[model samples]
Target: MSNINVDEVEEQMEEDEFEEELHETIRFLLVEFRGSLYTFTKHIANMNCERVHRPLNRRPITSRGYNYIHKILKEDPTNFREIYRMYPDVFLKLNNILREKTHLQDTRYICIEEMLAVFLLVVGHNTRYCLIRKTFERSRYNTSQNFNKVLKALNSIAADMMVKPGSAVPEKIRESTRFYPYFKDCIGAIDGTHIPATVFGRDTNSYRNRHGKISQNVLAACNFDLEFIYVLSGWEGSAHDSNVLTDALSRNNGLKVTQGYFFNATSLFNFFLFFRIIYSIHYCGVRYHLQDFTGQGRHPEDAKELFNLRHTSLRNVTERLFGIFKSRFKLFKTAPPFKYTTQTEIVLACAGLHNFLRKECRSDEFPVETEIEVPPSSSEQVYKDDNFGELFDTQEQQRTNTNAWRDAIANQMWSDYDHIVNKS
Candidate 1:
């Protein structure tokens, strides 16, 4: 018993010594070298015995934290060359939040550079763990395990940094609202987007609600500045946007707004008054309409010709919300090749990181393009009064459904719009 106790003490002391040595070594290295590709390679070779003899590339630098900075420069070469230059005050702000000595032990990927790199990957590429691993080969960690750890760590950190604990808005944002009155009463804008996934036959109908595919319903709430405030990304894709909102409202403690309202589309209803509805028209001609249900007649607003004309057009926050999110992260913009579980996590991580960068940016200039292809000619016909009423009546309907939430709420807000339209 005595010998065993002695050995245990010795092992603990050795661990402490090893930790101290590692820290000292990293500090020494930081002081010793300038961040050139050749110098970085030589430094890593000396410090990490596991690194192989491949010429240093983007991946290795990613592990070391230089590439995220490099990427910032590459993207905006005309504006800035150094990461520190673009975000001069960021390190100081981060240091105040992330105390240096606390997260320094037993973490290969905890450094500021690595965290930012992980954030960039999730939002910029939204790539898989395996692909990220291949991209940063110098990481001496299992791809999946490290990826999950990074995500978990980021969730806690970002939530702490960006989420205003007990309040839905972040501190900087709540304070900034004085200058930007659009954000004054607004806590966030809510919406749902579909993430594609594979479906099993047994679970086909469960995942195939009204949307027509196997997908996870991704629900997000962004502030007026378009930074994500809350993200709930794992509901079945077939789930209605209302259902997703219901889940998110119930899940997170901070998101439940007991007092105020937010903005969303008409798909969400009166139970959650937190949203100001964005009105849209869905026309189906009575004859060509393949749907089982009969039209109540033309919308009263259609008859009065006032639904589009009378109301003060509030900001289309939801449209801009989808545009900004998908624009920054291509993963959510297009259908992914991955199956469900992986797809959900990727989306969640991207949302979390979006909040992080939006907080970090000194300038809100999002890069205009990412080489993503857009249709040169939109095939969607504009709804003009002349033929629009006749046009939609001809379309086929695979599913005839009304969101229960929407039906319940429509009368409360748009009662005037409802009274004017005529029925079929």
Candidate 2:
């Protein structure tokens, strides 16, 4: 009876042990299944959230923009001037000069020609960067980067392109009897023009001119050949021409006036001394503009009018230069939304290009006989400052001599003009 009771107890213990081992196996399998399911679900979510980077400019070789540029250069070379504001040869020559002289280099994808084209499109037509990107079939980053690279390259060769005046008299002045002896000492004409500008914040007021437009008062000196010799830009529109001139003369790389030589200016700059600048007379009720003397019986009646007529003729060159410059580069008419410093650099670069074009192709699109009438002056008050007077007081004797010399020339010019009219 005792042996049978012990056997029953052993059998019950074995059954309990087997049931606990089965439970442990089932729990391990359940945890392993949950972990595998969680990992699979996380991977699916990640696949759904992944981003693919598609290229904006694909197959650039077959792009329409790239084809168009090459087509214009090869098949339609004549139209190149209309598109780039320069003949193909001129453009190529300029490109060569820039490549040889500047730090600009051809990248793996973009050649120097394409880079210059991008810059010219922006400066020539004021085309926006987005449009340029589409035209050139380049990414935004490439278009902007190349435009700036070309700009810096052009500026690097500015000195060579924008040549200064030599001591010899210009052929235009030397050939004309009306200007020869009178303006023999004159090297160039100096004037101030307003270029459209874009500014922000409190600086807008400072850039607002008397004409109620935001602009930059750019002072430029141009030879009679319609080429810029010196350009001083970046002054606020509210600044007077004399003030801009003062700053230009004070700068280290500013306009340099050779001794005994003068620049022809308008009546606005009459008070300037220590510089041999011959300005028009500001007498009240006198005819000073060129249009006033452009009729059948509108010849000058006095010495002052005679001097003014000739001065207006000589000074009109600067106005014509500005006209041609703005017409060539529409960027001057409307300012692009670039930094102010960049805008100033653009002005200088454009001037350099103008000079280059003049040298390369003298008979370009600009009409030689186009009559550009000088705009009438809005104010007759000659720019004067007590500070300027005090600074230049020591040169009073020189100023007096200049005034006397001007009177003598006017008298001589009137005498010659009167004699001619009477003889006719």
Candidate 3:
């Protein structure tokens, strides 16, 4: 009985040892499996982090924007004007001027030409920045920044480009038989035009014109050459032409008229105060507008008619200038959503650009055609006579003398015109 009991105890002890060894193996396998799983998770985490921090590859190595510009400038040069609104040489010259004269500098990635192209596309075509970004292959931030920089650069040169008129008579007047001696004292033409504007709040009412259009009234003076001599912008469309002219005269750096010389204008400026300074024919119940004499057999009937015709022809220069200006820069055709101050600056900048283009490329083609008809009651007239100093005692006397002088000139013109017509 003792031997059997001892065998049983030994068997139990062997079973206990086998169970302990199996438990140890299970724990070891579990630890090894957990370590392998942890390593796999770490690898995946590393790959995900790399992907999250990767730089975007949007623009290609050889960008389409750069390629398009290169192609146009090199292979397709003529299209440059269509795209940029100026010839290659003119554009390059302007770019150089901006670079040398202003604060605009080329970035490592973008050049001055690209910057200028962006600006021209915006102002010339009134193109949106999104399209410009795509065309230039630049980010929105870069495109907008460059545009503003170019604008500032252009403004810096405005003073040099938009110069005051010289005292000498223009060649158009000096050479023309109809105008030479008659308009010898005339320096240029003055007129008021409306430019579309965006206004808000109480300002909207002030900007609405007689045509029921929201616009800004711009008073401009131009020589017969279709170049802007003075430009006064930002007045509300509801403002009178005479009031605008008054404001221009009031400003310290406003339109400067030479003594004894005058600017031809419309009857809108026929005020008692301006009679001595400006000359307007008596147009009440008369045929004075240019459109009246357009068709066949529309010759002047008398001295007043003849004088009206001559005055309208000479003053038409200002209208023609406005036509060319609005045609060349389409930005003026529509109101861009910008600050009023910025809009005013744009007008001044465009005026400077017009003068620059006229001086640089005399034959630049204007794409749009414009014909301006002289409205009824819009008789061309003339303004500040410093040359007639001490000639009259009072304003009334000055006005009387001005009217008499105008009549004498009209009679002389009529005599010469009648003789020529009879001879012909």
Candidate 4:
């Protein structure tokens, strides 16, 4: 028999040790606090009822809470503290809004504040449900049995009460004043993003596609306020953003731009007269904006180029929404814990929350605008010729008209956006 490979044995041993440590760490419980829906109810009940309750003992806290808490908080102590302090106030405000909605029952159910607490805790800590059970020890929600129940309750409320369809343009969001005039014909900015999810499949074709990738393609739209207006989740990761957009547009009648525009990236192809697509083109490696009906790049230095820039600058509403949404929920930073079904629900819920916040706070006027570094100019980069000519034919009548309208609308909006940006 050959001599045993000591190096291989040591590597295997190390791997086993690492796995064991991970298992232990995941299961270990740190300082148990009393923060649960049951405890929450008890606190309310105690406030109203003339009953004496037994006081619970305080114990040394675990590193898990601090570790998870650190993950969500910003690096700068001052900034982190400021946001942390606002959590309670924001919770109360969101709760009051939910109460006003009439969707929640009046029978001493979970309040909106508690629901906000759950969201903040989940987004901030990215911790498990059971660990959250430990934080509110003094409250009525301490029972182990009610952990899932509370989560379900919060989910239901978020779905039914917090979210609203943004089909119609609100007066506040509607363009007004030349500095930032309402884009009357444009409905929303559309985009596709990747959110990680785990799925089981023996037949690779079931989930895998031409791209040979594994992830979910989430198509979401945001209004002018940088609020997520609509979400189309559950498309396979291999699906192109254009295909996802096509499916979403077909599925929802409201999404089909009958009178207004739906701005998207340049990858999306041309559509009919009713639906206008304003996208950007990458010329010489540098992304130049355009509103092309034929989906073809016409002139680099023409008025059309300026129109594309305006279109992109405005259409980028969805991009900012994506950044902020994922930054808040680190679960999106990596793959989601749940499968596709639950993942879709969570994504939609997050979009709703994103819009809810945008509606609640219209202006995020920060003082330190210059603190953020500006990206270096790429105007002089080497240009590559993307074959937009293959996508369209100039002889097509509808395509010609569509391009004309797109150009006109873009020119109008560009002047308006430029004024707004300049004033700011």
lDDT, candidate 4, 31-81, per-residue tens: 123346567687767663323344545332223333334354435545542
Worst 10 residues of 1 by lDDT: 304-313
Q: Per-residue lDDT of 1-424 in model 3, one digit per residue for the tens?
A: 9999999999999999999999999999999999989987886677531122223655432244555665667755568887777888888888888999998997655778888888888888888888888776677778888878887888778867865778787898899888878888888888889999988887799899877789999999888888888889999987778778888877888877766888887677665344335644444566877788989999899887888888889888877788888887888889976788888888888888889889888798585466543343333233344643443345666677667877887899899999998999
- Report the lDDT tens digits of candidate 1 across residue range 171-288: 4335642212323334555656665665666886776635355667777766556666677777775565655666666664535443444443332332333232222222222221
Q: What lDDT does candidate 2 reach at residue 150?
A: 91
Best by lDDT: 2
Angstrom error at residue 278, model 2: 6.1
lDDT of each: 0.48, 0.80, 0.78, 0.51
Candidate 2 backbone clash number: 0
Q: State the TM-score for model 1.
A: 0.50
Estimate the lDDT of model 2: 0.80
lDDT for model 4 comes to: 0.51
- Weakest ten-residue segment in model 2 by summed lDDT: 47-56
Error of 4 at 247 (Å): 2.6
Model 1 / residue 288 / CA error / Å: 23
Candidate 2 structure quality by residue, lDDT tens digits, 238-321: 888888887877789888887778788866676667555444433346898877888899987899888888887888888789
Which segments of candidate 4 are over 4 A away from where they belong?
1-86, 97-116, 137-184, 203-213, 252-265, 269-300, 362-396, 407-424
Q: Pairing residues by index, what is the TM-score of model 4?
A: 0.55
Q: Using lDDT as the measure, what is the rank order of every candidate, best first?
A: 2, 3, 4, 1
Give the TM-scores of the predictions, in the order they appear.
Answer: 0.50, 0.80, 0.78, 0.55
